[model samples]
Target: MVVPLTVALGAGPAQAASCSATTGPYQKQVEQFLGRPVDGRQSSADCLAIQAFQRKHGITPTLGYAGPLTWQTMYTMYTQQWAGTTPNKAGKCPTNRGRIACVDLTRQLSWIQDGARLKYGPVPVRTGRNGAETRTGSKKIYWRNINHWSTLYNVSMPYAQFFDGGQAFHSVTKSMWNPPGSAGCVNMRPADAKAYWNLLRNGDDVHVYGRKPGT
Candidate 1:
């Protein structure tokens, strides 16, 4: 079973206290909402602008903190409403000769970095059944055929494989949308898989771990 994660926006009492001042709270809130970290204390305008951004994401304006409603809106971004919201930044990734990639199989998601900046998630995925679970260990992006499509894998997708072991990340078919239905590989919704593939590069880090707080 997958444990549901209560979106970590770090808005507990400690954070609240640390955010007592104008700079601390505003800075923290902006980073928490945008998924981008801030360097130091921020100005009131920054806080207000962040509040505006939050409103765009369906959250009502408030004291500019990542409170329950804001976090809930962010949660919605990862769930059913993700397609309309995911930023199209296929050209944003910094490409180089070699890079490492990682995935959290249990969470049915992956994380990528172009040697800098931690991109938390676009997390859209499907997992294996009780018999065939997604493996966890070191892996690499052995190929980069952008035109590849999911064939016997059962989904029409821009696909890639690691080590020829048959494990891969690709677009999901209708059958695999539910948990316990995929054929032992990670399955992703069409848009998320494509976006992820675009963000990935050859030799990017791919770490597949077990059950996260929420699968």
Candidate 2:
């Protein structure tokens, strides 16, 4: 059954000390809110801004990094809302058991969760477009090749975490927002893809749902 995740932004502690900052929605939002450069690269100056904001809001370390909690707090306040306000213990993940990566294509958001605990994401992702729309269903990551290549498209699909056939979670450019996305692949920025590479492994569950609006 397809379901939209109904997670409230502040339901959890928000910032876990070990969490790494993400780009797009998290980094970009934080940048605009702090008036920092929106080059999409997290810099030391950006960290300072984050830290300052965190301190002001009582987030520990003022670490200057936009962890999940910090991002959630900032995103909630800045946008005036989150994807959903109700606490969804299931998090729309396929498995109510082990580590699962949930991708909400409609909202361009992806997050990894270990049952009830969020491991990462709820960050922006670019999925397949129109004729190449990414298939939505539950699948296991059959393999992960950090330097995978697509002979069909002749393009690099780095940090490839494959689930259904050639469809994978791999790195793409910021311009992925443009026309003609990858050939059914779930695309992430280089850094985020790397992070996913580090966190996920073969046999992990991937639950993809919702439609990519323009596709």
Candidate lDDT scores, in order, read: 0.50, 0.70
lDDT of 2 by residue, 1-215 (tens): 21122222245756332322434347777787788988876665666567667765566544466566566555544432354432234356655758988887766667788877778866667788789988998998999898998898888889999999889999976543433455688888788899999999999999888777656
TM-score of 1: 0.45
- Candidate 1 Cα RMSD after full superposition onto the native fold (Å): 14.0
Top TM-score: which candidate number?
A: 2
lDDT of 1 at 142: 69
Instruction: Write the residue-wise lDDT of candidate 1 on 59-172 in tens digits.
Output: 443344545545533443354344332322332333352343445443344545445444435455665656666666666666655556656755554554442267777765
> What TM-score, to 2 decimals, does candidate 2 have?
0.59
Badly placed stretches (over 4 Å) of model 1 are 1-99, 147-155, 161-164, 173-177, 211-215
* lDDT over C-alpha atoms for residue 161 of model 2: 94
Would you give me the overall lDDT of model 2?
0.70
The C-alpha RMSD in Å for every predicted model, in order, reads: 14.0, 15.3
